[model samples]
Target chain A: MDRLLFGDNQFFGVNHMSEEKARAQSMKFQDLSAVIDVLDAAYDEGIHTFMCTTHDRVGEIVDYMRTKPERYAEQIFYPGMPYAHKYANAMTEDGMVGAIKRFLPDGGLLDAAFKGGMSVAKKDIEGITTLLIDAEMKMFQGLPTPVIFLQNVVVDLLLGLGFKDAFRIFAEHVRKKYNAEPGFISMNLPTLLKVLKEVGVENPVVCSNINKVGFRMSGGGVTAYEKALNEYEFQAIAMSVFASGAIPPREAIEWVCKLPNLKSIVFGASSRSNIHSTKVLVDEYWVG
Target chain B: MIRIGMVGLGKMGLSHYSMVNAHPDVEVVAVCDSSAYLLGLLNRYTGVETFNDMSKMLAQSNLDAVIISTPSVLHAQMVKTALEAGVNVFCEKPFSLNPSTSRDLTELARSKKLVTQVGYHYRFVGAFKEVKRLLDSGAIGKVSHILAEAYGPVVLKPKGSTWRSKKSEGGGSLYDYAAHPIDLVNWYLGVPSEVRGTILGQVFSRETDDEVFSTMVWPDETTAQLSVSWSDPSQRKMSTKITVFGSNGRITADRQECQTFLTDATAAPEGYVEGWNVRYTTDLTDEVYFYVRGEEYSAQLDAFVKRIESGEIEGQNSFGSATGADEVLAMMVADANRDYAGIAAGPAPQVDRGLFRRRTKS
Candidate 1:
């Protein structure tokens, strides 16, 4: 993990605070080249890690990156799995079996299918969980995926359902299978960390809403998040640092960077200046 | 009695087991399921031997035939194993996950001279059977086009965890629900020579498709459209209907009844008249010895038993027909997988010059 990792919310049109802005961002990034151009700008500025959702269009970006290997030699992809919409769309069109066939690794079809069956029949949650992770990670094969994330949609749902063991299952599978650190993104960071610890996952890397003014921070707000960061040993990745454009760049970064044990900040920016200025603020404030 | 061994005691398997048990000519000698709970329940109640493995059931039970209700992915292997054991087989629909494996199973069954059937019970539904009869009798004249739809509310939300929603386990509406209509089209109009305009969409389930739309052209040039969805909330549970259009009239049929409309008196069945006519499935369907879901299930089982007893390996719902349908489905899936731009780039239809000339003359 670096001091700043480029987020994909802007490229994918996911603005939490404003639906109008989200729609505008979606229209702007309909063309893949526009997304690549912005990514190129960020890359040129020495920001290489792209923590993105496993959207279908992201496959195109991954393919594009493959073509220009030397240019993206140091690039890292942190793919969040079970892209709910992609799977939903694929399942609606291809059917469960057909969609699995479409996404299963080229040569591991039988193995994956067998694991899927075992997962279903034996209640092998580990098998099913790992199989899904494998399916989600299929497109990122041969790429630098040092960290794979469980998307917040599922993370929070599992949290609500009290399926805490799933966190450990995901961690074990990600470590054993992809040899990558399993990261979790959630709306409630304190609860997730507590559950992750209960499941025997120590010092886990978690990303959550950790901005100034308590925008969307559900579990005890900014004070509790700061206390958890200072007291807990887990590595923290701060997201929603700008509080959906509510907080000023300098104030938000300065506030978040000064927080103890804040290992990195993930931010989305469509323009070079936004990316560069955000990076500059983090560099200036992050004394460690 | 023809001794039968049942495998995969899931919903379909249990239904088939009771039907087979009720048949005087068929005896369910043993059952197999991966679930020990289901196997134990069957063992305690039925007094029939049970096994957790299909091969053990096949080997231990002195079976003349095997009924496979396993998931689609296991169909080929189970059917292959039973056929190689010289036992007749009645497997469930979509016979195999893919075409090549389906072809292999069909070829193996043919070589062994086994009485094999695929559980496409819709083929035995009286209304659909009547539809087939009317089509074959030319009551609707030369068939020009057909529309087959199968809709159900099995998956209306994100169900990526279930085997029915997972692609690896043969989940998705395409393999699960659409096969019925695709098979019906194959039975009504011979194998399709070409397929185009496929749209596989997802409504709810994240891992597999809940909706499938595709078009096929048969050898005789008659076209058919297939639309299947498992996510439509308004649909009845597993409702399958088909409409056929011909030069003279059109016929429509579902699980309940078959209806036909004819312009000419000459193009009607024996009891049917020119205008519109309807026949309820209860009237047309044969009396089943045991009924679970519908008479079609018993009818299909009886048909399979008769085929096995009489050594008639080829028929309406035999493995041969199933393989033919599987081949068509595989072709449709492959075509659907092809670059959509190719189909999207098709030329616009040309104007009818003869119609214009006739208008000008008039």
Candidate 2:
């Protein structure tokens, strides 16, 4: 993984502090060309890792990137799966069977259907879980996806549901099938690391809110996160490092870069200057 | 009598079967379903020719029309095949999963001069129809804003087991439950020119959305808000309600009743006056030929059969209407996706209390 992973929240219009700014950013990036332009700026700044949700539009970006292989040769995509909105929209339009048919990897319909049916009949969570993973991974086929993530919504829900075994199922399948590391994003980093360890996942790459202000960091806030960082063997990717713009850029990056066990920081920006400045700051403060 | 072929013996299929079979001017000549058990049952009851394949049914049925109640993903292909086979089509909503496909089907139907209808039964509901009539008559002058809401308790759990929860097959509240109110919006006001502030989220369902909220603006400057939910426990099975605010007054309508309140004297249809007026669906004067779970279903079917028999190519509920509705649905979904990905600012600020007082005093 890169030391600094570029996040897609800016392109997608996700601002925790100001809904108005989010909407404005959303209107600005309605065009794919605009998104590509910003990404190019980030890439020019030497930040090649893009951590993104599997929104339907991201599929278009993937297709565009695939067309220009050399241009994006070193580009890495960290696709977060079961983009709940995509599935929700698909299910709304096509129904469950139709949605499955639409999203299932090409040439694996029967196998997936059998697996799905068997999973339903026999309570085979592994089969069902892997099948869904494959479905979500369909768009990333033929691309450079080094790390596939389970989105926070599902991760937190499974955590709440006490479905700890799913983490192992996801990790193993991602490694075995895609040959990629399976990453988990959650609001509660300490508990997730605990669950990942219980499921026998060693040195897992966990992404969560880690910043000066402890914005959205739950289950004991920054104190618990710091303890987890010191105690756990897993690599940590700090996100929301801006604390939803509550903290200054330098102070936030300065505080997060000094944290123990922190391997990467994922941040979103729309302009080249922001990207370049953030990159400079991270390089200056990062010990490694 | 118009000969009809029934396709897909699911819930909607059986409902259409009963309605078509009961209509005096229609004869259900054949039926098609993947399940032999359902085919056998229908054959035993209706004595109609049955086929396991749609192509076989289309070739041998000698039907004048086909009523398609299959999963929405199958609509484009089925409607295209039926229309190319020279049979009119009455497809269940939405017209197709994609707007382009829906447009293509509509073009084919138009080139063939076929009578077509998309099942937006709410349009046929007496209360809604009256609302439409009132709007058309300018009962509420210069409409400014509208709120269309459809809520039900269909998906309350983490069950992503069905096609309704999938996006590929057009399974979500946006397509299934929201399409009604969306179609109503398109019918009452033109298709929105701009859509923003969309929020499509899952409440309890694992994969698909149980709630959708969006803001749409028409070219006429009429802004509308659409909120559809399949996870609201407070709602009945399927409740569609709309409130229209115009310069003159406001009108609110659901399946059972239409209520109106006029602030000043305005021209309204007969039986409606200047003040508060409420009309129950039973008071509707337009006679529906048949009644089932809803008169709208029967009325839409009756209109389709009548148009086919009379060789009329276009009218309300035509392919054009369905295609228009499908386009608007596509826009709403697209905007919702954008909005979900788009940033959220805080809620728009409220009117200043001092300004409000000053304006009132003036």
Candidate 3:
């Protein structure tokens, strides 16, 4: 994994610290070209992996990147699955059946429906999980997706609900079917790590909140996270290192870079200068 | 041990069920919802009892407490049934559409000596709770003005109607969106005595308001302005922000952090200094056993369980307090439709309706 992975939160109007900034960026990136410009700028900075949610707009990015093969050959996507809002809108707009029909991968629509439908009918976690994974992966067919993530919404839900077997099922499918590493994003690092280890997912790639002030860190906050980092064998990706811009840039970067087992740092920025500066901070302060 | 039954398997319901089901002292014995698929999923996964009917669950599950997350229209009946069955209740917000129903339910809960809590989860948010602490501790002096605001992208375009757009079912933006901040204001400065300058504007939905703007006056003449809208595409999700202006200091807080400006540190709470001080959510929040969207979500349900164990009849966000907020909402809705002649101090010029007049068909 690259030391720095760019994220898509800023382009999608997600600013944890301030809504005004989120709205401004959202409006600025309304044009697809603006989004591409930022991605290209990240690429120029040598931050190639774009860890992004599978929002519908991202399909446009995949298409645009696929067109310019040699120009973006090194860049890759780390797509997160089952963007809840997309499915939510679909569910409300067109009920359950319509949602499944709309999001299933192309071709053999009836066959796909029968398989996915039977999963829904039987309430099989693995069936629905793979079906949705295939659906989310459809847009990134030819893209280099070395890592696929289960978003925290469902991950923590499953963790708290004590369905630890789902982790094993997800990891097996991602490895056997897609030949990619299965990643889990969660807010509760302590609980999620315990579950992952119990499920025999050794040396897993897990992304979570890791910062000095413990912003958004759950399951014992900063101390528990530090313990996990020091004791655990898994590779950890640190997100929200700046605490959504609440912490000073230098302090945030410095604190996170000193952590152990830190495989990558994912962040989002709206400008070329911000991206360059953060990249510079990681380069200067990285201790491991 | 407290045995509980979960009602309504929607978003909030499912979230609360997950949190409370994992509590060390609480057991989610049965799950109730209209969808058989959800019930089957829960029953199959966890080997818990499942019910399609609320009363049957309340009776057969032998529940000591019931957590209700149904629609606001159904909250009144579900809450009353749970209370009548001698079960402690934790319900989602906007306790009931009708203020009278809320009042009667409050009475019923009190009469039964049952623990009752309404899911105004914002009250459990660490920053918001710190704001409450500041005001109560006199760190902000006496608040004379407040600005409470909420915005979300629930309805940005002309969209088909959902339960949220129907005033009777979900109470539109006024009840669904604005209730959070309004409950905070009510928590801070009781219910307002006078409500005027109300505007129930419709941006997209024709059946109900998409935005609610009103100014409320407390008995002490402390004024608060409420500006809320669900049509703002800028906000990716729902955000509730509250600012209190006091004689000696001020406080502004949302889900992220709390900012307090004090003139003097002499009376300020410990760990806070004079001038501007900011407290991040991570610093203020206590770790929960089961973390979901936010710590507040789990904290609220944990609070309910603690209340049941401690025999606490009065909840910080009890049906009684939600009734206070509901009364204010009732006043705002009424004021929007009321017609009153302004008291003109001097001669006013007569004006034609012009473009302001409704276009009548020929």
In DockQ terms, which candidate is top? 3
For candidate 1, the lDDT comes to: 0.78
TM-score of candidate 3's A chain against the true A chain: 0.91
* Native contact fraction, candidates in order: 0.00, 0.03, 0.28
Against the true structure, what is every candidate's RMSD? 18.9, 21.3, 5.4
Off by over 4 Å in 1: A1-288, B342-362
Per residue, candidate 3 scores C-alpha lDDT tens digits across B1-362 of 99999898776787788788777798888888886665665665667788899999887888999999887899999998999999999989888888999999999999999999888999998899999899889898888999999998777777654466677786578988888888999999989998988899999988889999999999899999999998887676778999999988899998878999999877778988889998877577777767777788888888888989999999788889889878988898899988755543556756556887864655
- Per-candidate Cα lDDT values, in order, are 0.78, 0.79, 0.84
lDDT of 2 by residue, A1-288 (tens): 789999998777666544346658988998999999989998988999999988888999999999999899899899998776555445544454455556655536434444443123223345656878987788889888889999886676556334577788899999999999989998768778888998898788899988887666765678888999999998789998987677899998899998987899999998888999999999899976
* Candidate 3 lDDT over residue span A1-288, tens digit each: 999999999888777765566678889999999999999999999999999999989998899988899989898889988787776555543444456657765435434434542133433556766777888888999778999899988888777666677788889889888889999999889778887998899888999989888877877788899999988878899999988776899999998988877899999998899999999999999854
Query: Between prediction 1 and prediction 2, which has the larger DockQ?
Result: 2
lDDT of 2 at B314: 88
Q: Could you tell me the fnat of model 2?
A: 0.03
Model 3 clash pairs are none
| DockQ of every candidate structure | 0.01, 0.02, 0.34
Instruction: Output the chain A TM-score of model 1.
Output: 0.89
lDDT of 2 by residue, B283-308 (tens): 55243433334556767888888898
